[model samples]
Target: MGNEETPESRERTDRTGWRGLLVDVTPLRTSPSFAKLWTGTSVAQIGAQITIVAVGLHVYDLTGSTLAVAFVALWALGPMILAGFVGGALADMFDRRTVALVTATVAWLSIGTMTLIAFLNVTQTWPYYVLAAINAASATILGATRGAILPRLLPTQLLPAAAALSGITMGLAITVGPAVAGVLVATVGFPWTYLLDAVLFAGAFLGILSLPPMTPEGGSASPGFSSVVESMRFLRNAPNVRATFIFDLIAMIFGTPRVVFPAAGALILGGGPVTVGVLTASFAAGALLSSLVSGPLGRVRRQGRAVTLAIAVFGLFTALFGVVLLVTGMMVGSAGPEGVNVPAVVLAGIALAGTGAADNVSAVFRTTILQAAAPDDVRGRMQGLFYVVVAGGPRIGDLLAGAVATAIALWAPALIGGLIIVALMLVLLRIARGFQHYDAFMPTP
Candidate 1:
């Protein structure tokens, strides 16, 4: 205890024995404010998921096309990317708490508007696109700001633990939200479901309001085009950070299989909206279980290796999902009442849950890298860039999955994407020994 112990070193020592795997994070979970933020975010996220399912269901009902449902995400991607970068930069220039509060208010208002439109029987596709895009864009901004704010609230060593906790929140939101949404949409109708989200969004506002004013780590930079360019230059010089972003982009771009969900729900799995909910929730369920048992993650020192390995595992699980789907297709033969089977759906859900768990582990490490390594003054801009990569990459994956599924089969995209991810990660790991050996105890410049 008297020795010169850094956070990373202490964490490593805490994991030295078999019992190290059971290292308690309770001692590190001291920040009441962070706990409050976590709680608020968790609640709001559940509501958000409910709205997402409702919106997709509403769009598909109106248009009767999988592409139309996919377009809702595609329309939002560009604006969301731009807003994330701008929001991140603004977070560096102003009070993060205030920024979050204002943006969250806008988000809630957008949802309220959507609810009104739905209630009025305006079931047109355009309104859904417009409102969904606005909501997505606002969410992008909120995500970046929130990412930047976390490092300020917790100790560096606790970052992994915090990430695990955040994963739990995400897991809970996704698991509960979509499942509940499926029930509500099937029973209560769409307007009430969207309205409920608007109400629950107030929880997010409360969380942001409770946070202390946190200015940029360094003095505020002027908000302008030049500032953004300067941040880009900073990122160019930071090879480790660049590598982390690229790796995450590759994983998301290749690994995300969300677009195939509706097709799987209606045809392959045959449970309709309920199957979609279950499939989606399966991923969150896996993530939630992983985070609940993630005491071992807090002690890992080679974070870069951990991230790479976790992402690779995610790809493997994703591939497994594709294989499971293929097997289900083989068993069912076609989309019909007799083809509707429970065991096949359950197997696919299990595979998806595994993928979600692995992805959450990767997210924790990637987030830790961004929070710990990036300079405070430039954190917002970097976060914004990170947001763009994270958000943008998945959309690209959606497009790819949709195209491939339409062309060949729904199962082909996952099989090909997973293989590509494994190959890409292996190549990246070999080339960048620096990333693999990155020590959390010794932060890179």
Candidate 2:
């Protein structure tokens, strides 16, 4: 315990709270492979964001229906789930490096195909749907592979820090990526933005190539029904891991308010799409700031307790955002095209930022728990489930928010959903003894 404060730890923290907030950079310095992996994903994610937004813009440009643009996610959802399970099984069976490399190559090729479609100036909706689905499937695989890859790169004690670092990576990608994408699509057009994604995707290959061979210690299981059953059985006994997934789902499904942003921008806030972008990015911006100052998180002994509180805070902020919208809507009617409630917009953004910060804190602990507690052989499958929960939860959220918004007011759904999240999370934590008492220092799944 006396020798635990290494030079790297000293770099981020002191007795003072301000000094203790910086993210630890030890993972980057100690593990070059992890560093490469982190850097590669960070660079490529910016380009990925560009292509994602560009494709949506291209679709809306071709057909002026916002509903058609929503098809992008719907088409991809099926393939994304299939790939997650297959990818996890394959990762446990083969060398992790090889699995990542192959999946990354597929993802790269999908982007390359998009570039070709852009160059051809194809306006067909079917082709766009197909390519977007392919890209999503490949990305799902890549995420599971990377989740399994991280624990091997760093020691258990540093898993929390590594998760924080990854949070920072995600925060940056989500914060800056789409904003840049919006500008690029408006100025340079769509093809170049897609090409940038194709070029940047090669960075993932560099990271995969740098890793030492990582063969699973536990015996391999081939991808099929049997593998799925086996993994499911393992999870059935892994109460803590299951609790993590449930907690995340409750947070995302009830707290996510992304679907209402457009309504808020148009009807309530009045600033139009620009306002929508600002509000959307505000959440990620807070996440970025929180991750940068997450050095103190590693010291927390009861990570489950931390996650519980953070998620509750997230719910509270989400409710606050809804209140901002509700009050703004009352103060003024719909302001037609390009209208804005300046003060309300600012306050709404602050609430969203707070939600983002709390959510990121929960994410760091949840991710650390999965990586540290799960065994090497089963880690891939656990990670795959994690990806599914994480990726799928928001889509469910979108539908919930959208449907509820339709029935009631734009702000009412989020307000109701947030309250539901707070109540549900508290109930789950109180009932689930394993989750509430989960210790970071001696992790179990």
Candidate 3:
């Protein structure tokens, strides 16, 4: 071979044998813009997770209700859903760099205000609700804009690898942020926690600022009701993309049991905020580990099949998590933080981590399918919808879990929801045969 290697031959070399079993770092090496964006966004996400966990704990501590904590998601749900469409349209209409910067600024301001409120000792929960809603909406928009920008920065073949790497970013954010928040909130108080988040969000500003101007390719549409309608019409014809959303909604709405973690830690598992943080981090730990070893994923041809199988495994693990909680509650009824059921916590952590890993796998494939199949002109809108499903589905789950746990038992929702997810996936496997056999080389949405 000559001293200068061809890009095509080098890519083939990157995917062979042992290298195929690890997360492909080619995207980062090939594109400096992508690297900077991923790095800054990852740092900011850790801070965002800090605020997320803190807010949930604060609400739970004040009201002592899982339902109360669930309402935090409810408060942001409407605005966030609306932002998904509006943000997508904006991304397509303007320079995505500008879109990301503006939305990131709004989100940063929201965090700063939260810090101010906490420092002022304003115990009023309404302000928290208002600010959280604003932040959520802004973040939803920012996520859509950033996602749309991904395809512009990297080659088409590298998108799957990029998605897998995102698992690492998510894993780090959720894993480290909650773990830190738990200790900080328990020791230093909420003001310091909020202040730290504000400082971290500044990194996101740098990432977005560094990006080159990225306007929609092919054509642009005005950000309006008509543009939103056009996107829905496209989705109606795009069965593959439609299926991705449906499966994700089922998995997130039913299988996600995050709402009950606060109560589980406080009452059953017995580690309080520290336990809550650890439990939450376990899920991300699974995702992080899975992403690290996701070398073979880039070579898979039937991405749809992979997505389905991964989600089914997620449901199984979610159910297992419920079983662990049930056994813990039965053995140590009404135990507090001082009790600390070590074995039960370990088992639950493993199960939640399993769910996280499986979910991340499905996310990687689903995102690739959406990015590869959708037309460039409408990619932002599609990504916007994806954000809503990815983000909003959990909020809906929080409502379901909170209500079900309050009405039935703490473990009932996960058990019932997990079973429901598995059954639905089976049904979907039969009906969505096209999706089940989706060819990566010949992507169709």
lDDT of 2 by residue, 128-183 (tens): 88999998888888899899989888777677888888888888888777778788
- lDDT to native, each model: 0.82, 0.85, 0.87
Evaluate candidate 3 by giving its C-alpha RMSD to the native, one decimal. Answer: 3.8
Steric collisions counted per model: 0, 3, 3
Tens digit of per-residue lDDT, candidate 1, span 44-125: 9999999998999999988899889978888988888889778888888898888898889889989999999999989679
| TM values, all candidates | 0.88, 0.95, 0.89
TM-score of 3: 0.89
- Ranking by lDDT, best first? 3, 2, 1
Candidate 2 local distance difference test against the native: 0.85
User: What would the per-residue lDDT of candidate 3 be over residues 1-445, giving only the tens digit for each residue?
Assistant: 1113338426844576777788888778877788888989889999999999899988777778887887898898889989998999998888899999999999999999999988898877888889999999999999899888887787666778889999999889877887789889999999899999999998898788889988788889765799999899999999999989989999989987888998999888988877786788788899999999887888788999889889999999999999988888887765443678888899999998999899999999999999888877788899899888877888778889989999998998888899888888888778888999999878877
